[model samples]
Target: MAAQFRRMAMWTWPGAVYNEHPQRMVERLQEGHVDIVIPYICGQRDGHTCWTAEEYDERLRAIIEEAHRADMKVHACFDEVNAYRAMPVYDLRQVRKDGSIGSVLCHANPAVVDYVLDKLRWTLAEFDCDGINLEDGYIFNQNTIYDPAHTTGELFQVVPVCYCSYCQEHAPIEKPEWAQWKQEQLTALIAAESALVRKQKPGAPFSVAARMPYDRSFYAPHKQEVPYFDGWEVCQSRDALMADWAAWLRRGHIDFACPMSYFHSRRLVELETQECRHLSPTAANDIWIGLGLGECTAEYRQGNGDDPATENAKDPALRNDGAAIEALLLDQLRVGQEKVVFFSYEHLLDEHLSVMARYR
Candidate 1:
C-alpha cells in the first residue's frame, strides 16, 4: 500500500480539558511523526477565554523551537469568534436590541477590523511561525437582519450585535433590505485582513473555517433573518460553501482551505473527500481536511465519556485501538488530500499518539 498522507496535530496552550503543556505536547507530536503543529493561540468557551501569548510564551517558544528542530511547521490558530463570542477588540456598533452586548462583533465596523488586524500583526511580529489559521472568523448568525428601529438600512440579524448604542444610532436607511450586505461586510473584512497579512509577509498562508452547507436553499429565509440571521443555511449549503470558498481561492486570498469535516465514520470522510475534490479541484490538491481525533472514537460515538470502548462499533471483538485512526489517515491519503490536521493536541493521550505514529 502507498504510504499514508502526512499528519498535523493541533495543540492549544494553557491547555484545554487535557491540560497538557506545549513542550510535552510537542514531544508527543514529534514521537507521533507529525509534520505540522497548529497551536491554538486564543479561543472562547461560554464566558471564559484562553490565550497563550500572555502566560505561556516561554513554553510556547520552546515548543516552536522543538517542532522546528523536528522539521515540523507551526500553524498558529487565531480564533476570532469560535464560541465564547468575544472579539480581541470591541465594536460599539454591534449592540443588541435589548441594550446588551453580543458575543460577536460587526465586521462592517472599522474598529473591529482594526482590532483583528492589529492582533494578526502582533502575532506575526512575535512568533517565528510558518503560517496563521483564522478559525471561525467569518462566522455570523444566519438570523440577523437590518433593523429599521435602530438605523435606516442598518444590517441587523438574530446574532444580537452592535447594540452598544452606536450601531443602533446609525442603522441603514435602505428598505427591501438584504442580509447579503452583512455577508459582504464579513467577506470584505476577511479579504482585507488576508491582504494586510500578505503585504507584510508575502506568500504567508491564511485560511477561514467555513460552515458546510449541503444545498443552496438549506439556509434560505433564515439566511438574513434577524435575531438569528437564518438565511445563511440557504447560501451556505455544502456546494455553495465550496463555491464561495473557490472564489477566495481563485482570487488568491488563501493558500489552502481546511474544511471542518467532523465525520465519525470512514465512509463519510470518503464521501466528503469526493465532494471536495469535485467542488474545489485546486483546493483539493492543497487543502488540509480538519478531523476530530478526540471526538471520532468509538467511545465518543457511544456517548460514553472518554473511556475506551470494549469493542469497536464497526467490529465487535476488534478492540477500539489505533487501527481506526490508521484507517482514517489512509482514507485521507487515498482521496488525494495529502495533509490532515487533528482538531487538537491538548485532548490527545498516549494511545492517540500511538495511533498517529502508525501513519508516520
Candidate 2:
C-alpha cells in the first residue's frame, strides 16, 4: 500500500544456480516487478583471467538479450576485489601487516585498475547492458601491524596492509596513510571507469554497490555496536578502500550508489536512508538504499565476519520475512522516498515475489 518506485532493481551473485538459466532468471525478475537486473559476472578473480574477454562479452550478451526481451534493462555488475585469482598475477595480492598476503587485487597497483577498466570498456562496447555497477570489495579484514609499546607496556596494533614493495612503490607507507591513498586510487578508478563507460556508450548509467556506514544505534539499549572499521572506516583506512560514497556521488563520478544497508530492522533502514540523504542531498535520489532479503538473517550471521557470539544473541525476527520485508520496502518509499533493490533471486521466495507484485 505504498507509492511505486520510479526504478526497481535486483542484484544477483555468482554461484547462484538460481540464475543458471538466464531466460528463467529474467522471467522471475519480470514477475517480481523488477525494472532492472544486475547479474554478477566476474567470478572469484577478475573475469578476464577467469575467461577470455570475448567469452565474457558473449555470455553477457546472451543474458542482456534475454532481459531486453522481457522489457527489463540489464546492468553488468562486477566485484572490484572479489577475485580469488586475478590475472597478471603480480597485481592480485594485497600485503598484510605481518608481511603476509591478502587475496584481493591491490588497489595501489595501476595495473589492477587498468585491468578493471579494460574489462569495463570491452563489455560496454560489446554488450547491450543499460549500465555498469561496480561492487566495492573493501570489506573488513584483520589489522596486524602493532604500534610501539605504550608507557603502560600495552601493545597497540593496527591492520598495516598492502605493504608489498609494489604498493609502496605506488602509494608509499601503510595503514592510515594507505587509507587516504586508497580513496584517491579508488576515486580515480571509478572516475576512469565512468569515463570509459560514457565513451563507449554516452549517458550510460554507472553505479557502485557501496558499503553502508555503521549505524551507531542499531543495537541501542543493549550497547553492542556493529564493527565500525570493518563496515566503515577500516575498508577506507586499512584496506585502502573508499566507501565515502557520498563524495563520489556528489562529484558525478558515479551515477547511482546502491549502499548495502543490510540491516534487519526497518527502523535502522530509515536511519541509514536519512543519513545518505543528508550526506548527498543533491544526489539523494540517485541513492538506492539496498535492502537484504531471503536467507538474509542466516547470511548476516554466517557471512558478515563479525563475532557471531555477539550478533547471534540478537533477535531472530530481523530479516527476510514477508510482512517485515513489506514494511522495509514501504519504509524506504514512504520515509526515504528512495528506490530499493533486493539482494538476489537465489534467496527470494514466492512470498517475497508476492509482496513485490503490489508495487507493480
Candidate 3:
C-alpha cells in the first residue's frame, strides 16, 4: 500500500444532481475514502438562475445530510468573482479597462461585500455544512482571460475590473499603489468572511480556491500543452490577482489554502508545489494542492446564455486517462504532500475513484 492523504475532497457545482442523486454520489465517494465534499451553493451558477441558497436548499441539504451519514464533512463553496444577474452585485461587477463590466463581482465595494456576506450568513444558518470554501475569492482582472465578447483585435482594451464609480469616487490615496491597494481589499474581505464563518460555526475550516503564478519557466509546459489554456503573460498569479491568500493564512483568517495547480505534467506539479513552499514557511503546511480530473474545453450556452447542467460536463474530451490519473495521484503522494483535493466531482470517473481508493 502507498501513503494516503490527510483528507480527500472534491469541488463540485449544482449541476451534479442531474447525473446521479446527491445521496448516491456521497455514498460512492465515501467508498473511496473521500472525507470531504465541497459543493458550490452560493452565487449565480453559470446557466441556471440559482439565485440564492434558499433555491438550492433541498439539493444542498441532501448533499450535506448524506455526506454526514457517510461521516464526511461538507464544505459549501461560494464564488467571489462570478455573480451574474440583474441584482445589485452584478451591477457592481469589476469594470474592464475598456470601461465595460467584467463577469466577476467586485468585493472592493462595501455594498457588494454586504450582499455576498448576507447570502453566506443565511447559508451557514441553514446548511449542516462543516465548513466554507471560496472559489475565485479575489477582485482582479487580467489580460490573459479570453472573453468570448472580445475579438482578438480589441483584446488590448480590457483589464477586467476595479475602475467602478466607488473606486473612482473614493480614492483612498491621490494615487493609490496598485498591489498594496488590491492586497488590502482582498485581505480585508477574507478577514470579515472568516470571522463570520467562525462566529457562526466555531472551528469550521475556511478554505480558498487559491491561484498559481504564471511564469515562462515553471508554467510553460502547462500552457503550451494544455488544450484550451491561453498563453497570457499572467492569468491568475497571486500578486496580480490581488488574492494574497498566504497573508490570510498567516493572519489566521483561513484554515487552509488549496491552489488549483492542476496539470498532467509532473514537472509543472513539482514547480507548483515548490512555489507554495516558497510563499512562507509558516503557511506552507496549510497549502493543499488542487488536482483536476479534466480541464474544461468547451461549454454550451443558449441564446439567452443559461448553462444547463449535465453529468458529462460542459465538455470531457481532455480528461486524463486512468493511467495518467493514477501516476499523478501517486506522484503527489510520494512528494510529501499532506493534502490533495480534486478540481471537480462531476468529472470523477470510475477509474479516478479506483486510484483514490487504492491510496485511501
On lDDT, the leading prediction is 3
**Ten-residue stretch with the least lDDT total in model 3:** 297-306
Q: Compared to the true structure, candidate 3 yields what TM-score?
A: 0.82
Estimated TM-score per prediction?
0.72, 0.81, 0.82
Off by over 4 Å in 1: 6-19, 43-53, 81-88, 91-101, 143-177, 214-244, 296-321
Residue lDDT tens for model 3, 66-158: 888878899888764576674556788777567877777766889988887787788899888898888764646643443211112222222
Model 2: worst 10 consecutive residues (lDDT sum)? 145-154
Name every residue pair that clashes in candidate 2. 44-83, 44-84, 45-83, 45-84, 143-159
Q: Which candidate do you rate higher for lDDT, 1 or 3?
A: 3
Rank order (by TM-score, best first)? 3, 2, 1
Which candidate, 1 or 2, has the higher lDDT?
Answer: 2
Candidate 2 Cα errors over 4 Å, as ranges: 17-19, 43-59, 138-158, 174-178, 214-241, 298-306, 311-316
Backbone clashes in each candidate structure, one number apiece? Answer: 53, 5, 2
lDDT of model 3 at residue 28? 75
What are the C-alpha RMSDs, in order, of all predicted structures?
8.6, 6.3, 6.1
